[model samples]
Target chain A: MSENLPFLVIAAPLFGALVASLVGWARPRYCYAIAMVSLAAGLTAAIALLVKVSGTVSGYEYRLGGWPPPIGIQHWVDPLSALILVVITAVAFLAVMSARANLQLELPGKERFVYPLMLLMVTGLSGMTLTGDAFNLYVLLEITSLSSYALVAIGRGRAAASCLNYIIMGTIGASFYLLGVGYLYLKTGSLNMIDLRQIMIAGDMHGSQTVITGFILITVGFWIKMGLYPLHGWLPNAYSFAPHAASNLMAPLMTKVSVYVSLRMMLSVFTPDFLAVHALWAQTALLVATIAIIAGSLIAYSQTDVKKLLCYLVVAEVGYMAGGMWLMNRAGITGTIYHIAADAFMTCCLFLGASGLIASTGSRHIRSFRGATRRMPWTFAAFLVGGLSMIGVPPTCGFFSKWFLIQGAIEGGAWHFVAALIFSSLINALIFFRIIELAYFKDVEHEDDVSHPPQVQRNEAPWGIRIPLFITSVVIVLLGVFSPRVINWIERFVDSVGVT
Target chain B: MSDVLTFIISRFNYWIYIVLMMIGLYAMIAKRNYVKKFIGMSIFQTAIILFYVSTGVKSGATIPILEHGHDIGHAAAAINPDHYANPLPHVLMLTAIVVGVATLGVALAVVQKVHDQYETIEEPEILFKLGQE
Candidate 1:
């Protein structure tokens, strides 16, 4: 039963999707309940698997149909994957918890199909995290991308064009990944990650041109998926134009899950020793990552729309994680893994709160946040907490991850990354403070307010919106205080995978 | 000269795939029309499919189906590794092809919507309309 947890986590959502399609149109009310219950179950199973993996000596691996590697699809739940799986499930659950209210408002007639699309997306992400087969990963990635494309298009307005752009870039990304996977299969005659790793280790194929080409192709594919800088053109428009419910989920999990895939490629598919032989790529990647941080921040600073600003910040966050991964040390890997969860919860909390505010305020521009603290106090509080976390304040999850990321840069002697991280944090400070000023200061009744305080009404968003925002904000802070323990587990996993 | 010609001719599919891929990429990036871009996307995906299928061929091999009842072990015949073309790439390409079709369906649907809203699928005109907003 314990060994089956991985399959169960994915199966729950897949079943939910089936049920959703069957009953969603006729009994649309039940669709939300179904999605919530299924995602909750997936979250529980993921937590259980994480606990089981932590308690055991070795991580759990379930071989489908009792066949061995390269033939059977294997569910590999190492601590690293378990961590990411848990984050994805938890974020999916939180997004579902907050989706009901926003979905009704943002996508009025589309409620029937939303549940199944969201469920399918969750299942695809869970499958991507669990699968040990490279080809299986690609299949799951398409499942995720295809569902998201439909989900994005479900809304009115510019959503169709946004979804189309996402589909185009996403398909090309998936195609490149398939080509790379094909090349790897041709070189090694195995599609399973572990078997391919063993073959490379045995045959020392690291020096082979085919292997190198596969590496380059796969990295480019994932970078596109990761939305790292130049390849991030589709993200801002696509995510911001989608329904807030969709944006709330897509904003956090999409790139972070792709980062996990990239990590797997770097650590499991190609050993760290072999990566050193290709240091030039890592170095170039880090340089570009630094540029991404600065450029993303500068561009985000210029955005009038709150959602678009947050989208650009996500690109910068990707730069941070990618830079940490390229540092290629234990501290960096630990930071990168820890940041994956940290960033997800923080981003989810912020987006959930922002959507709530948008619903209440009836505007998308930053100017709409004027007096946000007055009308939506709890939602504003969630924003504030999540904002502080984004700014890397102490006792928030973001700070610890940034701390280790900076530590990694210092250790690796990469002053450029350190400078970029600090500069981006400063830019983050400016971005958040600007919102704060607008939300708090601009709404005050002029010079008379100093003498007489004006009453500000609290027309808070519903509990559905408030509860998830509260939970995610609490998660951000809790994960911060417990960062040491989290980092320990991640470090152990990193070492076990020979990342150091 | 004959050897060089043979070498080039043997891998003609790969060269064609490269050419098609380049054309598709250029269209996807530079074309102003959404329909043309979708065509480019289709061509891009097909080129990759072609590339994958071409990788599966062996010079003198038959299809990968097993010739049963003529067991090499029982007949004591020499078995060459390349006697059958690799089937894995073909199998994977089937999945890719399905994905391609699904993507195309969604792309066309979105294009329809785009056309309905703007009355044109040209990106520049769309951008002009968007700027008005």
Candidate 2:
């Protein structure tokens, strides 16, 4: 059981998806229960893996079918990947738990298709996180992307159009990644990441133009996939137009997983030494990330829709994670790994809260939030916690991650990044305050008109919605409160890899 | 001039892959019609498959299967790697082909939905309709 824990993390969801799709056609009611049980099982396996791995500095490896490395497939779970696995499963489980009411409201009678695709997407994400082969990662990335495209298209208005755009961009991004892996395979003759690294080191291929080209291709591919600034054209629309249930899951996990892939390539496959040799490239990447932070925030400030605003902020958060990783020091990478989990929960929290509010009020506009505290105070409170976390307020996970990122930027002498982080945080505060003011204060114009009386009846989302939002908020606080231990765990992985 | 020609001829497959990929990318980015965009997507994926499959080719190498598989214990030491073409890349591309087909199917289905919604598959016209609504 211990040895199969890593595989079980993925298989649970895969099995659930299969069962949901098969059993759903005849009995649609069972799909939700099946999805919940499967995802819960996966979450359990992931937590067990994390607990087991917590005791050791060196993480565990599980080979498929008892075949050894460099030949058969491998699932490598170090402290970092294990932590991310837990984050993925936990966020998915919460999102799905909340998804019942949201999906029924948004995509009625489609639970059968939606549940299976959601499970498959989670399976792909877990596989991408756990797999040790470069090519295997690409296949799993497609599985995740393909299911998400289908899920996004399940929405009503203009959904297929946005999904089409997402498909084109996603294909290009994935193809570029495939081409890069091809280049690496040609140069090193090995697809297994550990084997490829050993071969490159033994052959001293760091200086080879082919290897450099492969590195550039892979980095740019991940950049497109992760929506880093200039290449983020397909993100805001695809996410905002997606069905609320799908967006609740995809909005948090997709880009963050892509960022993790980039970090994995840099840390293990390409090695930090290769990056050090190309300091100019690293600086260029940092500069781009800084611009992304400022641009995402400034654009987010102009949004009228609450969901779209959160989508744009996600763009900025991607910049935070990407920029933190490029800082290349111990603190920077630890912050990045920590932020991935932190940002996942906070984003999930915000999206779930937004969707619940949207459902309760029957509107997606910012004005719908007027006197929201009186209308649905519990959901509003969850959104406020998420908003505060986004603003880097203390005792939430967001603040600790930002602190580490700032320390890393200062140590790395990248003042631009530090400035961008501060600037983005201020913008986040302004945006959230604007919403809060609308929610807390009475609409003055409406008070003057006295025609409508500003209906502020107490209407909250179902317990299905409230419970997940509540748990996610608590997790954010818990992550922040126990960040020292989390960072300490991340540091052990960083130290083992000799990244600094 | 002869040396340059030799260089071009030696890596002709890579050059073709790059050219095909660029053509596909341009269509996917610049074309207005949904069908054309998917056509380009298919071409783009084919180019990648070509790249991977081409990497597996070796001169004077035969298919990887052995005639006496049942007697592999006696023949295991006698196998020469250079005598057999690499099968891994080909196997990987089989998976890639399946993924490509799946992506193409999904893209076309979405395009069908777009057509049904707007009565047009031209991107610009669809956008115009969306704007008016």
Candidate 3:
């Protein structure tokens, strides 16, 4: 079972996506069932792999077709990969479930195509997490990119244009990544990330100009995909204009996956030793991360649309993770890994809650949330939880992740990063609290005559959407409580990589 | 400096690759039309493919297929090793080409959808409509 886990993880989703696409033409409802079962199986396999590999210090690498090393494609289920796989599968499953009603509401006619495209996107993200070959990663990245374009275009008017812009930027990013891979192949003549790492360690290619250029190119490409500041121009409109279901699904997971890819490249392919030898790269990452934190927060605070605000917040969170990676310490990497899971839950909860708000009130603007607590108390409560989590309030998962990240910064003697973290948190609080205040405190205006008072209806979002948001909110708090164990697992994995 | 210039001249494909890359990137950033942007993206991606293919080039190499009684090592001894292009980049570029085409198809479909919704392909016009909403 353990040996076949790699094939199961990739094949289940690929086959399910094919079936869903085919059957969707005849019976659209079957698409949801197919996608759910496929992702559930994937989640089970990922968990089993994580459990089996947890006790072992050395990571497990499964090569397809029994091919070895530099020649064949491989799937490596290391601690980091397993952690990311769990997050990807979990968020994907919950998002697909939440997407059912949201899709019906926003994209009634295109429902048949949405499920299959979403499944393909899941398959692509799964492939990215599992693959060890750099070129294979490029192929899978394109798979996700293509599906995401289709999904984003399903929104009402002008969404298709936003999707087009996404495709353009996504292609440029992927092309840069491929160019970087070409340069790496030129220097080392290998595509397997582990093989490339070994070659760099054995050879004097660490300081080579070509390798440095490759690093810069690849990092830039990932920065674009991860929506790092300045390159984040494509995200707000893409997330805002996309259908509610599509935005909820892609907005939380897409950039996080790209960030995972960047972290994997930084940690696994170019190890700490390489970065240590070249401290200038670390300095560059630190500087960009600081700017991203500041820019993402300020921009998020200025947005009126709920989805756009969350999109900018995603940018800020990416900076936090990038800052963690730049710290290059055990604490920092652990914090980075933990935050990946925490942020996924927090972002999903917020987006799911936003879906509810949009459904109930038919409004996406923050100001339109007036007196939501008095009308749809459940949704307002869910939003309050999600908003609190976003603000990094205690007893929520967000606070714990930020705690580790700030500690890591202080430990690394990067006090400026510590200051930036505090500033970002304060801004996050302000952004979310303003929304909460509107939802709770705003006076309701009666448009009807004085004789007929406007009656407050206690209509909640449908069970399908509300259930997922509630579950994710619970997970956010649970994750905070169980953070120590997760941190321990990350530390063990980092140690296995021979990093202190 | 002359030796460096000689080496660089011998590897003139890299210079061409760089030029093509710059052109693609410039078009992608400067162009406002959606289809033209995708065209730029395609050109940009193809430039990377060219870079990869060039990396495999040798001064006098042939294909890397092994004949009977001749392994990779023995075949290398028989032919001038510098003449045979590296096959790895070729293999990698095959995958890149497929990915590029897939991305292009999706991008074009998205442009078609944009035309259906907004009846305009210009970026500024689309933004104007969006802001009006």
Candidate 4:
């Protein structure tokens, strides 16, 4: 059963999508049910895999079709991958649970395709996390990209245009990644990451031009996908134009998973020794990340659309993880790994809350949020919690991760990044607090109006939506207080990859 | 000058890949029309495919299919690995081709939708109309 766990996490969703598509026309509601069940099972598999792999120095590998690595594909289940599996599956399950109502309303008659596309996307992301082969990662990435494209295209108005921009950028990113993989295969004669790493080190190709070119191309490609700083042009429009359900799923996972891929590549494929050999890449990466942190926040602050604001915040958060990891210390890498999980939950909470607000209040701009606190208490509370976390408020998971990152930066003597981290936290505070003022204080100012508006009444989102928001909001604080434990596990995971 | 000429002649295939890829990249970046952009994407994908197929080329090597009646894993009578071309790139490109097709099909659909909604496939014009809204 343990041997089959990796395949189960992926195959269940792929096959679930197939089944959902077949039974979809007859009963579209069944598609949602099927997706939820499959994601639940996948969550179980991921948890079991985590329990099995945690603290184990030697990770498990399940070769495809009984063929060994170097000749066939392999599914590697280290502590890191297992943890990511749990994050992806658990959040996906909740996203699906909350999707039914949104589909019933905004996406009437689209559940036939939406639910199945969501399942296929989950399959792609989890496959990407679990695969040990480099080329296999490309294939999985494309699967995720293609499914996400279809999902994004289903909405009316500008969703199609935004999706075209996304497809154009996404294809270039994937092609660049493929070209990098081709270079690696040429230099090492192997496509499996473990095999390539061994061959690279044994042949002392670490300093070779081919290896350097591969690293640069691959990092650029991933940076594009993660939408860091300058390459972030396509993200906000693409994400904001998506249907609420699709945005809920894609906004949180897509960039975060791409960050995980880059982290995995930096640690496993082009080991830390490469960083030491080339201080240039680390310095350049941190510089780019610092710029991203500042620019993302400033742009987010200027956005009037609530969803667009969240999209820019996602870009800033991507910088946090990327900058944290490149500090070339254990503290920074641990912080990055922890933030991947934390940010996933926090982002989900924020997106779901936005979806609920938009659906009920029938407004997409920040001005519509006036008196929102009175209208939807539960949803506003969740958004507030998520907002505080985004601002790095204590006792939320974001604070701890930022703490680790700052400590790592100080140790590395990268004072610029430390300053950028603090500055961005301040900006995030200003942005969220401004929104709070819009929601909370705006009504009291209008109290003196000669024509007083009718009091905003309670109209909370349906239970299907409310439950997931509450769960993820509670999860942010829970993960925060327990982050020390999370860090310890991540340290061991990093150690198993020999990154200490 | 003779060495430069010889070098270019020997490595011209790579130079071609680079040239085609640059052209595609330029089109992808600079083109205003959506179809041209997608065409650029296809060209970029094709260049990569061409690059991958080039990796499999071995001078004087036969196609990877085995001749009839070859011994099956006998220690003394094994087929030479070099006698056949590297098939891995070709196999991998088959998958890439499929991915390219999927992306192109989806992209065309998106372009169609965008054209229907905005009445133009040129990005600048759509932005102009959107600004009015």
| Candidate 3 docking classification | high
The candidate, 2 or 3, that scores higher on lDDT is 2
* Candidate 2, RMSD to the unseen true structure: 1.5
lDDT of 3 at A8: 85
lDDT of each residue in A1-500, candidate 2, tens digit only: 88899999999999999999999999998999999999999999999999999877689789989999888999999998999999999999999998899888888899999999999999999999999999999999999999999998988998888889899989999998999999999999898999999999999999999999998988999999999999999999999999988999999999999999899999989889888999999799999999999999999999999888999999999999989999999989999999999999999999999998888888999888887888888999998899999999999999999999999999999999999999999999999999999988755247566566666568897788899999999999999999999998999989988887
The DockQ of each candidate is 0.74, 0.91, 0.80, 0.90
The lDDT values for all models are 0.89, 0.93, 0.84, 0.90
lDDT of 3 by residue, B13-38 (tens): 98888888888888788988878888
The best-first sequence of candidates by TM-score reads: 2, 4, 1, 3
Instruction: Report the Cα interface RMSD of each model, rounded to 1 decimal.
Output: 1.1, 0.5, 1.2, 0.7
Q: Give a tens-digit lDDT track for model 4, residues A72-186.
A: 9999888789888899998898888889888877888899899999999999999999999999999999999999999999997788888988998899899999999999999
**TM-score of predicted chain B, candidate 1:** 0.83
Candidate 4 chain B has its poorest 10 consecutive residues by lDDT at: B67-76
DockQ value for model 3: 0.80
Once fitted onto the true fold, the runs of candidate 2 whose alpha carbons sit more than 4 angstroms away are A443-455
Model 3 lDDT at residue A181: 83
**Where does model 1 exceed 4 Å of error?**
A444-449, B1-7, B67-81
Error in Å for residue B28 of model 1: 1.3
Per-residue error (Å), model 4, residue A241: 0.6
**Residue A466's C-alpha lDDT in candidate 4?**
88
The per-residue C-alpha lDDT of model 4 at residue A241 equals 90
Off by over 4 Å in 3: A446-455, B1-7, B67-83
